[model samples]
Target: MKTEGGADAAKRRAGERAAEEVEGGFVVGLGTGSTTAHAIEAIGRAVDDGLDVRGIPTSFQSRQLALEAGIPLTTLDAVEGIDLSIDGADQVVDDADAAAFGTLIKGGGAAHAREKFVDAAADRFVVVADPSKLAARLERPVPVEVLPDAHTVVADRVGDLGGEPTLRSAEGKDGPVVTDNGNLVLDCEFGPIDDPETLAARLSRVPGIVEHGIFVDLADTTYVGTDDGVEERQY
Candidate 1:
């Protein structure tokens, strides 16, 4: 593992910790992110040591990383169901009363469309993150993936729903950031959400919306990494 110092080390601690959850014969949903990369590597090392498992990547980035790590890849079409999923979050907020955390915002990498599909399909979904991602409440810009032709309509609808939507642009290039599925991303800000479920429903109903970043009741457990150690929180 090319584990670095500071936040990267904390991320590694949480990620590798989640990787330990994998058992033999498990089909894993490999999520995308810097922190998730650590878990993928740990799983790959486990594979080298005779761990029998296959992984379904949430995005092209994850697919490539898994391959380089020597983790066997499988498709959702081939697997009956996923056993476990390990992923990182853009932000995770603590909820005093809920089955899972209050709110989770993901898709900073614009992979939420696929990430949500695989993560929600798993029997057990584990969230691994560095302490920086924890928040008092979710306030990050939500990412929504939509067909290119629907960008204008989606943005207007998002505004009608009281969110400020901005088309996500590719880094170091022109034009919008296109997802692996050839969709455009809209980063919508709605301030601190008091009713994530309602907002999620609203976003899902928008025409041409592929997926959104708001994840509620999906995470089974969250592992937050601090400089001291990995802090495990179950909801």
Candidate 2:
């Protein structure tokens, strides 16, 4: 039977497995979200145990976690290339595309823009998630970050793309949620996305759209945490 901490344990299993991918002298792209936080903490523990690696965090939250974990961080401007990136996904889709390794929807924390930039630069990008994240198709609302001035225009363009766009509001604060880059977020619902690339392309063409959460073919491998154990899937 699953304990009260079952979900957390599953996330931890997957996260820690991804942490094992980090090596001495490697520059890692730290991912955002609670699941990814486990990996960050694990990496921190490894750092305390003598791992010599630097981290490039995807968001403020990730940066804070990495700092707490004692994982040294460097900027992209300071690095030649990233060795690996460990990220989390809102949804992971198993598709039939022979050309693609993995398809994912991310940015639930409104950090997708930065996450994509870091993940794409990695020599190997790994996703860490619990089994609940895996799915047959992408069904989550895509988070789109846009310049504050272009919010209205981008929202309209998102509607043109057949997505219902809503400005993402903060939970505890009064106003909308803002990105680390000081941009606003639009949670766009287009329903089950059959072709994420096409949608991503469409979203990208919209001026003021910094980045969207539709991450297609960026991951090389995934560690999925199940109730029974951690499962490794090669993409």
* Maximum-lDDT candidate: 1
**Angstrom error at residue 141, model 2:** 0.7
lDDT by residue (tens digit), candidate 1, 120-150: 8999999999989987778888999999999
RMSD each, Å: 2.4, 1.9
- lDDT (CA) for every model shown? 0.92, 0.91
Candidate 1 stretches greater than 4 Å from native: 1-5, 97-102
State TM-scores per candidate.
0.96, 0.95
Residue-level lDDT of model 2, residues 94-209, one tens digit each, is 55463333789998999999999999999999999988888778888999999999999999998888999999999998999989999999999999887788898989889999
* Candidate 1 positional error at 63, Å: 0.6
lDDT of 1 at 14: 93
Q: In model 2, where do residues sit more than 4 Å from their true spots?
A: 1-5, 95-101
Give the TM-score (vs. native) of candidate 1: 0.96
